[model samples]
Target: MKAYFYLLFLIFSLTSHGSYGQRPTYSEDEIIVKTVTDEMDQVFKSPDFLKKKNKQFQDITGTMVVDIGIIQSGKVATFYKVENTITNIDFINFVSEYILQHKFKFKLPKKMRHKIRYSITF
Candidate 1:
């Protein structure tokens, strides 16, 4: 009878301890955003996309801030220039139109199907 009771106690203890072990947690939106942002940074750094428009103007320096809205379909639904050099308005507008026409892919969780804001500066 003592052996049976000891065995029962051991089993109960093991079962309770198992529940206390590490449990898997769901991914958060912040993690998703960080991952997508990193991927986009890599894409921008690639030479395939950043082609030189003017070879003669080697010293041309300007920065443009693009605001993009990622739709649920993983495409750029809307794009606009939020900020940029005053002299580069035409360039910024052209890029914004081009981005809107092109399709983009982003890895996002199903739960976050809503639109997401992204900013690009170059």
Candidate 2:
């Protein structure tokens, strides 16, 4: 049993800090991340985000991905990257502003900050 536990710990230690294929550098931060929760569904659908919607473009319809960074205080500080294939400034701004208004349900431990990737269909 002790050997099994030791092996498990070894696996976790080796994999925890290993980044595959040039992942974003979080070396300086002692981050603890959890999957986005059901509460985020409400945040995403809330009136705050809906109010910024622009339906002016009939031809543009797809998923927009954003990597949002949140400080340990649980507030979204910045969007590291926005993946809009069409490069629509208005749509990007709408999403970015909407995300800034919301906070993550999960709080990082040890006052560490982290980033999360999310997508919304337009």
**For each candidate, what TM-score against the reference?**
0.51, 0.56
Model 1: pairs clashing at backbone N, Cα or C within 3 Å:
none
TM-score of candidate 2 against the unseen true structure: 0.56
Residue runs of model 1 more than 4 Å from their true location after superposition: 1-28, 52-59, 101-104, 107-121
Q: Write the per-residue lDDT of candidate 2 for residues 32-107, one digit (tens) a residue.
A: 3334434455676777545545444445567777777877656788875566665777766766776787765445
Report the error of model 1 at residue 82, Å.
2.0
Top candidate when judged by lDDT against the true structure: 2
Q: Which runs in model 2 stand beyond 4 Å of their true positions? A: 1-37, 54-60
> Candidate 1 — number of clashing residue pairs?
0
Candidate 2: residue 16 lDDT (0-100):
78
lDDT (Cα atoms) of all candidates against the true structure = 0.57, 0.62
Clashes of each: 0, 0
**RMSD after CA superposition, every candidate:** 10.4, 11.7
